[model samples]
Target chain A: MMAKEISKSNYLQIDPWENLRSLSKARIALGNSGGSLPTREVLSFQEDHAFTKDAIYSDLKEKELLKHLQDFKLPVYQFQTKVSDRKEYLKRPDLGKKLAETSESENGDFDILFILTDGLAADAINERAIPLLKEILPKLNDYKIGLCLVKFGRVAIGDEIAEKLNAKFTAVFIGERPGLSSPKSMGIYTTYEPRSETTDERRNCISNIHENGMSIEKAADLLQYFIKESFRRKISGVKLKASLPNQIDRK
Target chain B: MAYKFTLRGKTYSFKDLKTVLAKATPERSGDALAGIAAEDNKERIAAQYCLSEIPLKAFLDDLLIPYEKDEVTRLIIDDHDTEAFKPISSLTVAEFRDYLLSYEVDGKTLKGLAPGLIPEMVAAVSKIMRNQDLISIASKIEVVTKFRNTIGLKGHFSVRLQPNNPSDDPKGIAASIIDGLMYGCGDAVIGINPATDNPQEVSKLLKQLDDFRQQYEIPTQNCILSHLTTTFEIIDKAPVDLIFQSIGGTEKTNSSFGIDLKLLQEAYEAGKELGRGTIGNQMMYFETGQGSSLSADAHHGVDQQTLEARAYAVARKFDPFLVNTVVGFIGPEYLYDGKQIIRAALEDHFCGKLLGLPMGCDVCYTNHAEADQDDMDSLLTLLGVAGCNYIMGVPGADDIMLNYQSTSFHDAMYLRKVLNKRPAPEFEEWLLKMGIFDDQGNRKELKEQMLKLK
Candidate 1:
């Protein structure tokens, strides 16, 4: 049987700059013979999505992350959440926010409490967390600090962690929800006057700190500046503004 | 008998051919050209016919007319071409800005165009210019265009009644629509995003909304924000004014949503075949965002915001009736907080408008994100100044099923009152007829309007 004819007006128009397709990966100026993408691109996108989903589960990296803390010879504590596994952590966000029954409280009057957790992107935490801390830790060598590795945690978990540690400020370096483009992206959320149920406005977030994106030195500089400013201003988030370089010239 | 052809569906026959040529080129009256001479009129008539019937690309070939061409032929032919037909690649940002700010002609030389031809011009031009260059030009040109195909090209807005998962029932959805209309929305286009992707359910929901439009005598358009493929299958069977899809910048991202350019084209064609637009209005409705490409892993290392703009280039292809960016709804991973969200929203609006898409914004954020209504308020006001086409409307600016906060129905009213803008023409008339809006487009008595509904 002859194939059914598709009409011209049924598709998108031809993109005029289709020949310049190689310059950018963005789907621009593609010819307008509109239809679904070909099979290869479709399957590749699906595969990428699967990769993003898999980035959520990286238990093998947990051992290496803890070892890095031990090698730094900094103080470290293991904390558990009310949630049992990553599945529960994702399903019941409320459970992820609370501490486990066996979680013991430790009190230490520290300047900044750095809490590490594999929050949605474990690879982000494993790759960026220690490297970022390593760069900034020396700048604050004189200040008292507490470090803790947390499991199945959320951004708010830092508030409770800081309350128990009795820290002046809290910086939670957690893996952000991975995007298809950058699955190993990390976020550093800091808050002042740390306590449970603190409104998000009191928190400042610095995100997209991965190997390919924001460098460790810059991330470290930002986190240190935020902590210093948080202490100086007695607040974070909307109240305090981070000043950027006035001039930039891209190479 | 001289010659005859149809222009904009009207058959113009030539006996003396004066009136026919006049109809074809209203800018040049037959009498004006007639007094010149009989032979001159014939030459002008043939030129006018080609101008009216042939597209610019085809007409460019006329420059190569094998027979001797003179200065008179060039002046007569080129003068009639809409400035939009100029090879946009040669124009600098300033020149492009000037072209977009106003028609750049003495009068409405572009009156005879099919509805949504601006998209055609934008698509054609965008192909020649870099997206960044186009966006820069669009940003500099602060011109507010009427949604040219519709009544009243002034600033207009719509409230998409999102009857999410738990509230997908017809009665509940109808109640939301009533709630939206009570606050003086439904102007731009009353669209719905069904929580369920089931094609049958989507069709039923569209029918239900169409019934409400008829029962309430709503003069505006309606749609179900489902995937185009789902809508395409049911386009022939449903009362769909627009086919909706969540478009992104790359083919992979679009394909991830189970749609490709071919599917989008098919939907466009189907909507056209169904006579989706009231007149010749374009019939595609697309929603885009910054992180969707990254979310789908198709961003190819491009920044999320730039990817969002390129998606507009894709949207301009179909000459969409609406292209909205659900800016902050994607969560904190892409656009981390209020500052980032606000910046991205403004950029999305700016980029979309510059690309010549009828740009709207779902000025929204998720509970998980560190954003508040105040952030939305600031963005909404800014978008109004930037000439956004519309913004989403939900009850209290919150979608319970979708788990996000968006601009509320009252927000639309606030924008209209503050900005001194009105809804689309037909919806504006309905508002006046229902006594919801006064002649000045202010709320007459919204409490009374609600009470009447009760």
Candidate 2:
């Protein structure tokens, strides 16, 4: 049998800064046995690697998700972009940025288009998207809202979805890129008059929505405030700044 | 192949050295430096001066006794006419010193020298000037000696204002620089790293910085982080105070940056030919990180910490004025988070200093990395204790362009107060002259001075 060649550095037994390792989960203090990552962290890193991969490639359960939408009395529209499968969606970003020609929304006219997308981290959208939307919808009662459920989509896909819906603003709740520590983090990207021409500057981002991140109630309140401010100013992103109720408005 | 010598219990090497010599100054003439060593004795001269502070002219005149004028003239007259040696030999010891100090070689003077000489001269100097601590080669690069006085001949703890971005306008960059200066940053050099790699864009930025320096009469060096080759291409068109490059631990890792030992030697020569240092000073600003080799997939199976120390060995070969290890910037694949970052930073500083390089820490973290300002605070304080040469001075410690957190201009002020340190000598003079800070470093009238620029 061939000898197994280890990829990591040799593990050392004692590291000088091992005492300082207590402050963080970062790999610094793991005393290298010979000269590399300790066996436990190597295994732990491999496990986290598998966990992040599963979170990114996992698909949403359509029937169970639709049940939550029905329970909230939120009308949902299922849509796809030009990219047909998850593989193509990951490979071709431009395809993910536009809607498929056959796609159409029943509720086309609204003040805002709310989209929940499975971007890179599908498990995050499957677990946290609906509950956060349920809390956010009540606070956004002042505006006419349309809901779109997107599959194999990214944040930019919402720009095309909102353009088709003829909504003035778009709030895209999508899964963020999974970090080793936080696999299920979500992000909200809000844009005014989003279109193919829209750049990142036209969209405002609020991120890190998960159990370990921003709570659903706080994200809902913040999203409501941003949407309200975008409507009042007729702008978002670089031009409009977000402020808490207790803070002074920069504008 | 290691031409190693130890000073203060630490060893240093002078391998593949080309630009480690001192520039000509009024106190030391460029011709005298050229005469001190010939092509045959480069290592001998380096080993001799690597651990002693006796001025070269003094070493030759007083210490190098019974020296034949013809033999010395043979060594000194490289390209110059041998008749040039006639005036040099007849002079008394003091007159020879005066002649060497007073003469200018190609519009420049030599303040200090690392002359390439024979083993005989190296032995002579070593036998005579056996000072315990060889004054750092960095101090000899410039004429003014006060810059290294406070740190006891070690390089001062300094900060470089890194006003970075692609679309950053001149006015915006200037504001950040002013903010840093007001808070006692930019002692090392006020440098900018433009997001775009275009040579024209980088040259334009250097032009604006030169204009700013001239307008304020700022008495420190400036740079834009362009590859040394790119800098060589543009230095003729624009002024660059230092040739900036990022080096790594392994030869393979350095190769990934399109650099090798030969390229480094060539870049050093190119920088010297350009002569961009602020009036005959050393001209190299290098950055390294612990995880950079592993991040670049060139760790070569050696551990990250040992690889980082090897990078310092490369840096000291050129005797750079600044070599900053941007600790924690590479992120989690190598150094996981704050704890790792803190440990690696101290290690980098300790290792760089041990190798006789003026080591600094970026003391930075990215948002994606599990780090925050508090981690930077702890690391900065610790590195301060470790005698860090410098840290990054980004406004608010937040780089809007890179979206990373580093030490702010305010953090530098805090370090200065707590550690009883100040910026490099010239910058301290500027601060005191501007009346922004007092003799005790108390704020005299910040709003009045800073608002005037805006």
Candidate 3:
């Protein structure tokens, strides 16, 4: 599997950003213990357009998804009116992420908000994003949940909305650009602080979190662990790892 | 039989998935970066990546040496020939998030946000801009066709033209564009180079243009526009902003002008000066009339590398980039010879990199075989590759279109539509959906229409 197509020199370049000296590489020995996993109330690709919202929501209700999201231990009161004409939505993205009318008039002080937006491929979000959200929602209670608004359309919407709502760690679950390899892929753009000016790299993303790749349950646990390590190391992306357990107890 | 793969300077062989895991499992690197790689590991990197390049090695050495814990640095390259990978993304989510949370709001910190937040927003903005720009251009192209098909334009080929009046006539036309709205029709972008050689002429031309715009109430949709060449005007004096304060005719309507880049960069570095986003620039291009030809000399023709210099300098200084290059030329000749120009621009490391609109040489070929006005312009417009202001001539030989100028006005108008916007397939559909002609930019009704490709 490793050597079919790629040549010798090229393959050598693989994972060079990681380490090289360790002669002893680890194999996932038959026993790998479970950390924190999720019981996913999975929704197939066809099930949830009913729950999905768009950049144009006729009337946004704030309290709708909160309770189920509340069980996740994170805040869900925030909702942005991610609605605007396609042109302004593209050019002036800042306006696309204003808080849902009700939330904009009112206020909430939650740090590090999480937004679940259906970017370029709303279909992918409808299929998988909601499931991943359901899985991660309950686990978020351990940390203080900032208010969030799930939007639809392009990813940059999160940048402006993040600034509008001052969040320490703002994460947006937007659809990834559908590669030929996978169209139903999802990614999490987690930034240190939410602002209109945040960029791609500054935000950590966990990609392939849909049916086409990683399982939703694994994605949820992985993200939960990612958050802890991110806060602990204060960094993420290629350099993230769960803290080593003192005891390797197999479940 | 063994299949071998090399990674991070080490070669490993895998007979299959079994041997693949046996050979190259996720080996821990204690050190994520070379700088932290306790001595011996760093030596190996020098041997593999360093190819007779010392400065490259030395540069990497210095970058690696600074890898103390806490600082996140990713890419380093010593090969000047190779693309230089930035170690830090211009902005990272971590830093941006902290900055946002840290922003001050009502005596309380609004997630610690600050002006530094501008960079990431800028990058993200640039990413999605392609879609919007493409839509705008397409709509313009399609819309012009709905009007006159045989269009052309004739304005100053060099100097700007301003009218002779001042106080009473704000929208009057300079002698250069006296034909004004009635001058061009159909699809084209004939630059109104009003031959205002002096400040007074420029002022007069400017006044005339304003007056003409007001008199005709020339909807930006009408095509012919004033491309004010103000660089030759008095730079040491004059209130520039007064002219630029004309974003009113249409919310997106821009009063265009051309400025020397070096001068613009100098002003930007001087301070947070305005006029950075407006008044386009003439970018460098390799244009030497061939068939009706001239030799390739520095002053004569420029490659992409030479052209992108001032703009990059300006962008580095955080100034907005607004310019177009003259990469193409027309005349008695059939095809444009821009081979040398295109090759160098693409190869040059710094120039024309990540630029939004960089046209290849010979942008519009086909010799205008298509007799239809739209066909001639679209074929020629490709040369722009979305860069440089596409200059079009009146298609079909109609001097009345140019309104007495040597070129045709009908062609210019059609080409102007292409230049000023991204031409759409169904312009009427887009306009009606966007409610473009209405007082309110009622794009709300057309939401589904735009997203659906026809």
CAPRI quality level assigned to candidate 1 from its DockQ score = incorrect
Angstrom error at residue B145, model 3? 45
- Which portions of model 1 show Cα errors greater than 4 Å? A1-251, B1-152, B155-165, B446-454
List, residue by residue over B1-454, the lDDT tens digit for candidate 3. 2334444666543332212211121111111111121134433333222211112122233332123411111111111222222321243322322232232311122112211212212222221222223222222220011111111111111111111211111222222132222222211221332211224444544454445444533322211121222322333343222121001010011111122334334444332332311223221111211111111011112111221231232232222211222222221111212332222222211122222222212222111111122323443444233233223332121111111112123333333344443222232233344332122211122223332211
Lowest-sum lDDT 10-residue window in model 1 chain B: B25-34
Superior candidate under DockQ, 1 versus 3 = 1
Error (Å) of candidate 2 at residue B31 is 51
**Could you tell me every candidate's TM-score relative to the true structure?**
0.50, 0.48, 0.29
lDDT score at residue B365, model 3, on the 0-100 scale: 19
Q: Model 2 chain B — which ten-residue stretch has the worst lDDT? A: B22-31
For candidate 2, write residues B1-454 as lDDT tens digits. Answer: 2235554565556441211121100111111222322233443444444423333333233312123422222232232223323333343322322343342521122221222222222222222221211112122222122121222123346788887642334555665676666666777788887533346767778989888878877777788986665676787788877789998766667765657777788878777677555445577779988656554546544345545665765676675878889886665445556876876676566545534467778998654455665788888887776566789887656564444567766677678778777777677888888765687764444433343433
Q: What is the alpha-carbon lDDT of model 2 when measured against the actual structure?
A: 0.60
How many steric overlaps are in each model, in order?
17, 20, 85
Which of 2 and 3 is the better model by DockQ? 2
Query: Chain B alone: TM-score in each candidate?
Result: 0.69, 0.66, 0.34
Comparing 1 with 3 on TM-score, the higher-scoring candidate is 1
lDDT of candidate 2 at residue A242, scale 0 to 100: 49
